[model samples]
Target: MGFWHTMVEVFPRFMPVLLEGAVIAVEVAAGALVVALAGGLVLALATLAPLRPVRFAARAYIEIIRGTPALTQLFIIYFGLADIGLGLPPLAAAIVGLGGNGAAYLAEVYRAGIAAIHRGQREAALSLGLVPTDVMRYVILPQATRIMVPPFCNFAIQLLLATSLVSAVAAPEIMFRARNLVMETYLSPHVYLLAAMLYLAVSIPMSHLTARLEQRLKRSR
Candidate 1:
């Protein structure tokens, strides 16, 4: 009863400020997604390169990024880089760090999707005089996109939630604003609960969309 009373008192005051932060969170997620998609695609192609050294380097990057904690990566981008005069703004650092981390994961997703397409399709494309790039662009990726869509959506949701980590770097996303509110109001429980709700508001829809995509994919299969 006491908690409910406090929540009622805080709700109106807290919501508007938190919504402003949510906008920034969405922006960060979108920026990071763009970076992840581009980097992941490049890394995926590199991993599949004919040269052993190229494949080895790409795999090493994927492994190293995947092996480290994301917070450390953010710190490196936001703080560590500053020591060498390569400081990025908090928002940029957040996007780059998260996107870089996400790329390693998404590269595997891209590889799996590409591999799921039959080798016969690639051979047929080649037999039609298509170069490797066109074979990938016209034949392989068109089919692989379907296989990748659901996982991509899933990863987007994960990335959205992971934006909370950026608060450590003072990027002023949802959790960062929530922490500030808690500090000012000394209402940790109420503020943090509202923050969680804000994240859910975005994440729930994304999760639903991912589920729908998976269902559609299964039906098509």
Candidate 2:
């Protein structure tokens, strides 16, 4: 049969399976984002810490993580961590691996957003007798957070796509599920096409949301 003929027959049959996989991917992304956002905040703060060593360590971490391929990091977490007596479950490993990778990029996003605010804003808050931490919490962060949102959502979308890499660790995400279905059904064209569409089903809506959010923030400013 021609490719289109086979796809017509197989696509509908695999749609549900592909969607189930996509759901898992979403879960992985959500879990990872919790880690990413928390860790990104710490890293962003470290970059501005009073201590020199703290800033160096944070910059080093961001550099090393951002420089490396995420797949390699995933392998280390999923496989290598066992060497240190820390054996993470596949799904847990996928979350940590993806989250760690995301934290570095998200740190940059937070950093840029925070830095974009005028220095005088921070100084003015300090003049009010606010401690450094209180200044960040009340003054800088409030405005900076608004700037961070659209970019953070964009990163979340990227993180969702990145979960496809979890298939390498057999994490049962969308790509992994689709690959198994393709092997079992021998419907590569249909399964893969459906898988791509499942991803688009996420990314397209998010892309529109990103644009709309950017417009809204611009107006609010």
Candidate 3:
């Protein structure tokens, strides 16, 4: 059948499966965002630590994660970790792998954002007799969060895209469902097109919202 013919006949059923995938994709993205933020904060602080060993370890992790392909990391976490009795479910493994990879890049982003703020802000906080943690919590982070949000939002989109790789390990996310639909229907083109549109539906709005957020943050400064 022709493309529209395929859409008319199959698209309705295809949509439910694609929507399921999109839900999983959002879960994976949200889960990884949490992990990335927490992990990035620790690594970013480590990179700025006074001790050389702390800084070296943080830098090494960043380099190693950045140097390797994310697919390899997923494989290692899903298959290789299983060999050591650390087997995680497919979704868990994907989240851990992607979040770990994201943390390295986010660490650099956080470090740059923190560094970009004026030193006077930190000094003024300190002058008020605020503790070091308080200074960072109140004075530094507010501004750094603004600078970090754009890149961080971009990273969130990248994380969403990367979730597609989890299918290799048998996670039944959108791409996985689409591939199954292709095999069942012999309609690869239509199946993939539907999936692409579904992804676009989520991503395009997110990008626009984040762009508006970035503008608001900049204006507030």
- Report, for every candidate in turn, its global Cα lDDT versus the true structure: 0.95, 0.91, 0.91
Best lDDT among the predictions, by candidate number: 1
Per-residue C-alpha lDDT of model 3 across residues 49-114, encoded as one tens digit per residue: 889999999999999999999999999999999999999999998889889999999999999999
Rank all candidate structures by their TM-score, best first, as comma-separated numbers.
Answer: 1, 2, 3
Better of 1 and 2 by lDDT: 1
Instruction: Please give the TM-score that candidate 2 achieves against the real structure.
Output: 0.96
Model 2 lDDT tens row, 102-177? 9999999889989999999989989989998898889999999999999898998899999999999999888998
Q: Which pairs clash inside model 2?
A: none
- TM-score, one value per model: 0.97, 0.96, 0.95
Per-residue lDDT of model 1, residues 1-221, tens digit only: 99999999989999999999999999999999999999999999999999999999999999999999999999999999999999999999999999999999999999999999999999999999999999999999999999999989999999999999999999999999999998898999999999998888889988998898899898998
| Candidate 1 regions with alpha-carbon error over 4 angstroms | none
Worst 10 residues of 2 by lDDT: 9-18
Model 1, global lDDT: 0.95
Top candidate when judged by TM-score against the true structure: 1
The candidate with the higher TM-score, 1 or 2, is: 1
